[model samples]
Target: MITVDFSLFPVGPGDRVLDLGCGGGRHAFEVYRRGADIVAFDQNENDLAEVADMFAAMRAAGEAPAESEAAAETVTGDALDTPFGDDSFDRVIASEIFEHIPHDTAAMAELHRVLRPGGIAAVTVPSWLPERLCWALSEDYHTNEGGHVRIYTRAELEAKLKAAGFLIGPHHHAHALHAPYWWIKCAVGTSNEDHPLASAYHRMLVWDMMKAPKTTRTTERLLNPLIGKSVVVYLRKPHRGSAESTG
Candidate 1:
């Protein structure tokens, strides 16, 4: 499921895109389908292999536009150190990834380094309030292997992006509907797949995603303004000649 809205990122056909830390390749798939030259960059070789296989499968099935063949590639690399030349992609997407990195400033710098002048990057992180609640509700939620290391306030995240050489853009919250499901998971046990309450909530979420029920949809719309689970922020690298500030 997409946490960040693509409209805010505003990519087009022929755009060179990078989905940083592209676990399981959800956002990367979207980029390829839109006729973008996409690289799913991650350190996990196995994950890259899976994403590469899916890319081939999609090409064979014509699941993407006929123009989409080989437009997608997978790169195994550290987030703090992407392998592309400087100013490579027109757009970069780093969703649900910042929290996992300890040196996120360095990672942000790397994202800034790889974007062409004026190219945009979209970032999604766990919203502070909902994430705080999750942490308060369950230790397992943030303490597990590869679990989130920290929750970021929007201001702090925005500041880091700006410091890393990005111009701030419109920001908003998303995935309100999924917040409660996580809260429920924490209330029971983060890994409690068989717990009755968690199971019921999971099914409801599945139905919501597949069926898009009006009741849940409307509720989420209302809740998103209040306590959405994910915070999406758009950023842009300044075009050449833009003034840089130390302030």
Candidate 2:
């Protein structure tokens, strides 16, 4: 499911977009469909391969706009040092990615470097309380090789982004219903696929995502501000004139 709100960080046809750490290419696909030139950047070759295939499929199926100049590609690289030139992308999306990076400051700097002046970025991380519950529930959840390394409070994240030269904007929480499902998984076992309760909860979540019934949508909207599992922060790179003044 998509985590970043497009309304808050709107993109247009031919806008250059980067989906950093694009695991499974969910956000990248959405950007492509919106007619942006999208690069799905990830370290996993297999995941990139799948994302590339999906891009081709979308093109073949005529999912992208005919008059739109959108193009899709995949790039495998380090987040701390992507290969793009400075001021490259018009927009960037980094969802549920920072918590896994050890050198988050460097990665943030890279994100800042690649985005053009006045460009917008949307960053999402695991919210503090729900993530803490997950870590408390299971050692396996955070201890794995690529698992989340830390939970972030909103303040900590905003500070880091500002330090990286981004001007922070309004933020919001998302995916309120996901917190409890993850808590159950962590409590039972991270890999306990056979657990009945966890399986049932997973199925329910899948249904909610696929069908998006009015009741569940309204419930999630009401619950989002209170206990959303992901906190999304929007940031903008200052224009050169404002950059000098802010500096």
Candidate 3:
């Protein structure tokens, strides 16, 4: 499921976008469909291979605007040490990645260095309360390898971004329904897929994502502010001669 809202970080034709830590390439695919040149950068070679295949499939299917300058590619690399030149991308997406990084500050700095002046970065992480609940419910949830290493409070997230030289912008919560689902999984056993409650919840979530019925949509909207699973923050690099840049 996509976490970053496009309204907060709009991409259009000819925009060069980087989906850092692209994982399964969900956001990168969306960026491509929006007519932006997208690079799905991840450390996993297998994942990048799949992402590259999807890009080819998307091109054949005419998913992106034919007349636009949209293109898609996959890059495998370390987030702390990306191979991009300075100010290479017009927009950057760092969704659901910071929590997994031990050197998040370095990664954030790389994000700032690669994005063009005034370019936007859309970052998402597990929200405080829901994530805390998960941790409290099960040690396995956070302790697993390649899993979330730290929980981010909104203030801390903004502070880190500011320290990285990004101008913080609007913030919002998403996926309220998924919060309870994760809590249930933590309560029962993180890996126990066949547990009745966990399985039922998974089915509901899959249905909600695929069908997007009005009932769940409205319910999530109402509940998001209080218990959303993910919080998305938009940030921008200061333009040349702006206050942050000049300093």
Candidate 4:
């Protein structure tokens, strides 16, 4: 499911987008379908291989618009030191990734460096309350290797982004319906995949994704502001000579 609201951070034909730490390429595929050149970057070789395969599959299935010039590629790299040159992309997406990086400021700086002035970066992280509940429920939830290393309050996230030279823009919460499912998992042991309640919740989520019944959709929208599991913020690197840029 998407955490970023495209209405606030639109991508279109010819736009070059970077999906940083693209674990399974969900957002990358969306960008490609929207007719933007997309690079799905992650450190995992196997994940990148699968993302590459999916790009081919998407092209073969004619997923992009007929006249679209969008291209898709996968890159394996470090977020702190990406391979692309400075000011390379029109938009960048860093979804649910900052929590896992120890040097998040450096990574944020890199995000600012690669984005063209006035370009947008859509960043997401676990919302503080839900994430705090998970941590309180189980040690494994955050302590696992490569798992979330810190919890982010929205104010802290915005402050760090501002320190990295980005002007914070609109923000919102998303995926409210999924918060309880994770809480259940944390309660039952994060690795216990066979717990009946967790299993039931998983099925329900999959069903909700496939069908998107109005009842659940409406409920999620209502609940998103209060308890959404993920919080997404859009930020812009200021253009040169602008007041926001100089100050």
Candidate 5:
């Protein structure tokens, strides 16, 4: 499910976009469909391979625009040190990834380094309240290999972005419907991925995403203010001369 809203990100056609730590290329796919030149960057070789193949498949299937030929590439590298040159992209999306890196600042700095002046970054993390509840219910949520390493309060995350030289912009909650399912999973067992109840909830989420029923949409709207699963912050790197303008 997408936790970041591209409308808030403001990417137009022909923009160069990077999806940092793009696990399975979910967001990257959306950017490509929007006609942005996309790069799905991740450290997982298997995931990169799949993303590359999917890009080819998408091209053949005409899933994108006729000019969708701008195409996406899979770049495998560390988040703290990407292979591209400085100021290499018009937009960057590092969703649901900051918490995984122990040195999240370095990763944020890398994001800043690669963005052109006025470029936007959309960073999503587990929202504080729901995430705290998950951790309270299950230690495994935090301890699992490559699982979420920490929970972020919006303030802390925004502050870190500011320190990395981004002008913190609009921010909000997302994935409100996914929070309860996670709570159920954590209450049961993090590894119990196939348990009947958890499995049912998982399928329901897939349906909610794939079909987007009105009922789930209404439910998500209601719960967003209360127990949203993800916190998304939009930020931008300032032009050299305009750093003081934010003041």
Candidate 6:
């Protein structure tokens, strides 16, 4: 499911976009559909291959706009050392990625380096309280390889991004209803898919995503600011020669 809200992170037609640490290419696909030149960058070769296949399929099926000049390509690389030149992309998406990287400052630096002046970066991570609950409920949740290495308070994250030279903007929370689902999973067992409560919750989430009934949508909107599972922060690279650019 997509976490970054496109309304808050605007991408004009033909805008260059990068989906850093793109897991399964959900956001990349959306960027492509919007007629932006998008690069789905990830470390996993298998996932990149799948994203490439999906891009080809979307082109073949005419899912992209007829007059749109958008194109999508996959890049396999490290987040801390991307293969792009300085000031390359107009927009960058780094959702559900920071928590997984131990050297988050380095990764954030790279994100800042590749974004053009006045470009936007949309970053998301597990919200503090909900993530704390998950960690408390199950040690396995954060201890596994490639699992979340740390949790971030809103202040901590904002400070780090500011230190990286991004001007922080409006922020919001998302996926409120999904918090309890994970709590249930951690309470039972990370791999216990057969748990009745967990299975039922999963089914409900699937239905909500696919059908998007009015009730769930309204409920999620109301609950999001309070207990949402993910926190989305929008940041902008300062325009070149601006006062903030001195950093």
lDDT of 4 by residue, 129-245 (tens): 999999999999998899999999999999999999899888999999999999999999998999999999999999999999999999999999999999999999999876573
lDDT of 6 by residue, 105-180 (tens): 9999999999999999999999999999999999999999999999999889999999999998889999999999
CA shift at 123, candidate 6, in angstroms?
Answer: 0.5
Question: Which portions of model 6 show Cα errors greater than 4 Å?
Answer: 66-68, 244-247
Q: lDDT tens string, model 1, 1-247? A: 8776888776667789999999999999988877778889998899999999998888889876564243788889999988899999999999989999999999999999999998988999999999999999999999999899999999999999998888898888888878888999999888889999889988988988899888988988789867999989898899889975322
TM values, all candidates: 0.94, 0.96, 0.96, 0.97, 0.95, 0.96
How does residue 113 of candidate 1 score in lDDT?
93
For each candidate, how many residue pairs have backbone atoms clashing (under 3 Å)?
0, 0, 0, 0, 0, 0
Per-prediction RMSD in angstroms? Answer: 2.3, 2.0, 2.1, 1.8, 1.6, 2.0
lDDT of 2: 0.92
CA lDDT of each prediction against the hidden true structure = 0.88, 0.92, 0.93, 0.93, 0.88, 0.94
Residue 14, candidate 6: Cα error in Å is 1.8
Output the lDDT of residue 23, model 5: 93
Off by over 4 Å in 1: 67-70, 243-247
Model 5 deviation from the true structure expressed as Cα RMSD, one decimal place: 1.6
lDDT of 2 by residue, 1-247 (tens): 9898999989878699999999999999899888888999999999999999988888889987553477788999999989999999999999999999999989999999999998999999999999999999999999999999888999999999999999998899999999999999999998999899999999999999999999999999999998899999999999987843222
Candidate 4 lDDT at 84 equals 95
Task: Give the best candidate by TM-score.
Answer: 4
Shift in Å, residue 147, candidate 5: 2.2
What does the lDDT come to for candidate 3? 0.93
Candidate 5 local lDDT, 34-138, one digit each (tens): 888998999999999999888888887988755434767888899989998999999999988999999999999999999999888899998999999999999
Better of 2 and 5 by lDDT: 2
